[model samples]
Target: MTCFAERAPAVVACAMALLLTACGSDGPAVVEPPQETTCNGVATSVRMLAPFESVVLSGSSAACFALAGGDREYLVIPQLTGELLPYGGYGFRLGDPSPAVVARAADTTSASIPSLSAEQIFGDQVHSLDAQARLDALMRRREQREATGVHHGAEQPTLSVIGVPPEPDTMRTFSVLNTLGETPGYSPVTAKLRYAGARVLVYMDTLATSALSTSEISAMGAVYDASLVPAVMTAFGDGSDIDANGRVIFLLTPTVNALVTASACATSGFVRGFFYSHDLSSTAATSNRG
Candidate 1:
């Protein structure tokens, strides 16, 4: 699985104005050469750890692909692997029970399984030991702010103008070709996405919001039917299970940089976005599970 977001010009400018700098495989084995017809500019074939299932490449550029046959659709960047990540590549699943394994195609039929894990997207960086210690201190400070009522909750606002459904002229149609040679038998897949637009919620109080971890802020708004719910509550499209599973998609765009150090910001790539696998895995009160 991969999560990728475009690098905004403003964000790139911010990084340039501020100046910032910023997993994977095992065993050699038989590898199938990728087809000349590339999927999303990746000449190399990519494989997922899950069984050969359904897939759909979104948009004409084929920048994103969604893995099917699961409860939630796994939108991924086919170009990236655990180890090698470009500016716009990363992978994680919201409700997937198993760890994600997306890697360059190899004949692993006989060879030991190629190691795989999530990659970072643009602006997404992991905290180092020192950074974590700094974050711990920051969290304590945030707690004090909360005690002083500086962190009072409010309604989350959606970016109504953003993610609007595509019109006929604006909508681009394409077929999803099988990139992974493992599923040669699978037929070509095509789809038309009717975007009713996503519920793009923006946390209003940046000062208070930035103080808390993304998970904490998410709990404040992303949880289903909870107080201060972020998403516009509604049954998606006639209330039917599109994937025949009792689950809905949830994504969190956190400002992880606010909690990290300048060195981390300078070294680690910008973290544009990420999924909440750890938050979902928890059965504790903080878990996003509903």
Candidate 2:
């Protein structure tokens, strides 16, 4: 399964910008969907890994797809309340046991996954050994700040690893197509859901072998829940717009630079302001526009 979120070079994460308003805690309220075609965007997905696959995924785009498993086939998803990411992708039910763990596994499994636009994003110069080592040091500093009760306008990187549920030998993984995650002190976020199953997670930036505050974990969990819980579970039963409800729709707006700048957002079939999208392999760059 493939899911994605937008990524920018700016590591300076802003604090929970607007006050952290209590999210859709009543849990995800179900909404009767409009006709599938009326709402859902064209279903699609980023490149995917083979079956029984796991890895860390980060991007500025949205991912779309689902999985099916078991003879009786049942999908198991972690309790993350977020909108089900949508896009054209392979289908399935049974998958790695947990998405959170899967997301985290991806982070650690590989030493590094190269970026699409290197000089553009990573060019900020992590200023350390490798990305992993630099990431490790960053996490340590975050802990010190929190311990000192330091408050700043910019929040640290959003870091938190999740365990994907283990599956059989075979599994599917997606190549980058969309973006994922919250603020700094964190890596990135991911969420994928379907009628049979859904997986969602908040990848906070921190050392894997450490414990997180109960409240911090709860808050991240709430973000996932706020976005997925009710959004996918009680979704309307219409397969026609199935694709639209599953993919992240692109609504591009030009930047002041005169060069085209793209902003990506998820448009689950259930959400408003979602539209159809065709593959337009594009990149956003901070460039000098004449």
TM-score against truth, every candidate: 0.25, 0.16
**lDDT of each residue in 1-290, candidate 2, tens digit only:** 11212111001111111111111123343332212111013332222233323332232121222222111111122211111222222122222322211111111111222333333223333332222222333434444454576455544332223223223222222122121111232112221211111333222222221344536555655644554444434332322221222322112111111111122222211111111111121111211010
At residue 266, candidate 2 shows an lDDT of 21
| lDDT, model 1 | 0.27
Question: Each candidate: what lDDT?
Answer: 0.27, 0.24
Best candidate, TM-score: 1
For candidate 2, which ten residues in a row score worst on lDDT? 9-18
lDDT of 2 at 5: 20
